[model samples]
Target: MRKTSLDVTAARVSPALPRRIPRLPGRFPRRLPVRQVLCLLPLALVAVVAVQHWTVLTEGFGKLGTGEWPWLLAAATTTCLAWVAAAVTRQGAVVERMPVFRLLATQFAAGAANHLLPTGLGASAVNLRFMTVCGIPLARSSAALALYILAEAISRVTLLIALLLAFPSALRLSTLLPEGAVGPLLLAVAVATVVAAAVLLLVRRLRTAAVSFLRTALGEARSVHTRPARALALWGGSLAFPALQAAGLVAVGQALGLQIPAAHMAVAYLAATVAVALVPTPGGLGSVEAALIVTLVAAGGDAAVATAVVLTYRIITVWLPLLPGALTLGVLVRLKVI
Candidate 1:
């Protein structure tokens, strides 16, 4: 039999695409120039502010050096536990099972990216890339990240509500304003609304989406309705992550010899965290510091003590992670992993 040209062409076509175009692995999409520049602005501002406030930061570090060793150690321990909690949440969401050690490494790398990248694209990029490495499709990874963000928002709001209920006076205490009579109250309401909306949307998405779709796109959602107990367990683990983070902040205050109570610390931390999260700043650098110090003072701390404690907390939580994150980025590049 004579071979037809159409028959030869049909055999050459790939399963991955419609026609016989050569299949090349795709590259990550380039960020738009305008967005990239906007992201860099916050990082730039962070550098400028840190440089301008070097003297104060130096003093804060000096105070940190004088902090009680046990308390400082405890702060680190609690923060480590927070990371463990985060990893547990992530593990429950992922599709394929990987070694725990590898997952932890990716988690560290993601944390580093969130701290070091100008726009924290590091976390998003790292998470997506890591998911790709685990054989998940891009859309599914994206959905997983969206779910993670929703989980975080819910947990943070829960903590915020707990703090507000415990310390009603904190409503009048934020240093985060033009000193308007109702500015803090308005901000609180705004934050609360955002948190509620985020949680509701996530819950609804998981509930309404078909099981097959959620299984592939956001696998954790499959359990959300069918297996409520597992879903709650995952949510509980995620909540523990941020709760431990707040605990770390409280320990930092105690470590610095600040006579702040844990309740006051929680309220101040929640308020400052919410305010700083609002800022466009990467990692909420200077904005976080400013909000934290002011909120701490409003929560009845001395200005100097509040400043010192928040500064130390940032050092441990922010700067300390940057070096490792930078190094991890380098390692990833060398491995051609990202």
Candidate 2:
């Protein structure tokens, strides 16, 4: 297939940004250059997060001042380190060893990008671009992305199950259930899965592409697992990323005096996130807060306190990182580091 302009532009690996920009004839430097816009878009979207949550940000600052300082500090610390965990997992996704600092930077930038784009499209695009800039082939880069996602999903579910089993009796799991809702919900989910599977199998082109993509992804997964260090990093980082996120939530819960056990809080966090994982909101924005608050309240926390905990957790994790992460993203793009 002939390469499109984007393919050609992306193929050029250089220290400077790719010249995919179009110049207007007799232009006065084109008031807003494409490159500037490209870099600014992520920043703008990220800044919108803070703007939308200005009340929460202000309230959160006041809470942090009055709330338990140590726990809030711990929450902030874990949130920052989640990016490092993500970077490690990204490294493990492919056989090639990316520059550590750049990879770390990319993950941080990806976080900012993830805020506005639904279902993680922003982060995925940024990471895919970074892989291409690092000279990885498009197919391999795609496979690597698939592997990272697969690992993350598996690890999250695994951790959730483990935690639930360990504290099953204490978690008041029944409170969250709408009495007979489980059976119907399960049936609905199963029906949807069946429908999706049927569609994939019935459509020849879709089936063929799906099979090919699976083959590539599986081959990449096998390759990654063969290296012990890589395998450890992949699985370890995947587990750590969500675990840290849950820990951050737990710390916030403690800081806000949420009347729930730490183990129960962790279980609630994981359960809420897993339940809303498929919701097509950016970083599970609205869905996550609603689900988490519900889960915490079901797990014996006061409703108002649960609301406070969830909002504060998001303020610390998402809002706090937006600006710096956006700056990092802009810098990475300006340096052609993707």
Candidate 3:
């Protein structure tokens, strides 16, 4: 069939019309920035947790009404100081001085991040980014992070041991494990170590990375120790961090009228924390609550009182500051401080 000029023109242009016409900017909404979304995610999660735990949280807050106000206030103060101790330890890990205000803010944000990420990954990531932005090299920043972690672990263990020795009768070591569990536990650890070693030996890249990391970590550790002030800050802050945390628990216990001795409560806090250290939950959430309750009960606290104290402590240290910490994290991210 013969086609009109208009028909021919329409046919020629129709296919290309869709392609030629630009997409209207207003037709589709722009996706939110990844950074903003990420910043909001933790806050959203915090809100979820608060909602889910509303009953427990309300009960915890209610318990505070009957608590010794002074002791509860002291607990809150100690919890706040734990963040300062963390910042000090971060400073001690590197030779270069970080901006004090930023460093402190980063630590505060890190505490919030800790709740969102597993095994303290959030805090580590934040601090590492902060250090890198402050002009520290990546390797050194990683090494500094390692040093901080090692120092913190050692200090926690050391404090635990000291408390145990000082109060031998406080925590019953024998009751912590079943009669025959130790042998199997040790065997399992040995097997795991051997397997890990074999895997590293078989993987050249993994071995190389491990060796390099160890060398850098060792070198950084030595360098940090050379400066007496840095060494003091690192070790002292590490020591104080866990001590203050345990003290906060103790203070909470006292406020809540937990009948357990303060020393026993301190030991319970350390032991419970150490037991659940490898659980990999964010800020040891569920694991921490369970361990604290169990350990406190084992340490001769009344179960009801122990639960109340733990709830109050978590409310004070974790939930209460959560929103503020999340806001601080958002601010730091916006500012590119972390």
TM-score of model number 2: 0.88
Selected candidate, larger TM-score, 2 vs 3: 3
TM-score of each: 0.70, 0.88, 0.90
Higher-ranked by lDDT: 2 or 3 = 3
If both were scored by TM-score, which would come out higher, candidate 1 or candidate 3?
3
The reply for model 1, stretches above 4 Å from the true place, is: 1-57, 118-120, 174-220, 223-233, 336-338
Worst 10 residues of 1 by lDDT: 34-43
lDDT of 2 at 78: 98
lDDT of 1 at 125: 80
Q: Candidate 3, residues 209-309: lDDT per residue as tens digits?
A: 99999999999988989999999999999999999999999999999899999999999999999888889998888889999998898888899999999
Off by over 4 Å in 2: 1-31
Which 10-residue window of candidate 2 scores lowest in summed lDDT? 10-19
The positional error of residue 15 in candidate 2, measured at the CA in angstroms, is: 38
Query: What is the Cα-based TM-score of model 3?
Result: 0.90
Query: Could you tell me which residue pairs clash in candidate 3?
Result: none
Mind giving the per-residue lDDT tens digits that candidate 2 earns over 27-48? 7544777777888877777768
lDDT agreement of model 2 with the native: 0.89
Report how far off residue 81 is in candidate 1 (Å). 1.9
Instruction: Write the residue-wise lDDT of candidate 1 on 280-332 in tens digits.
Output: 65666677788888888877788888888888887777666655655655565
- The local distance difference test score of each candidate is 0.70, 0.89, 0.91
Q: How many backbone clashes does candidate 3 have?
A: 0
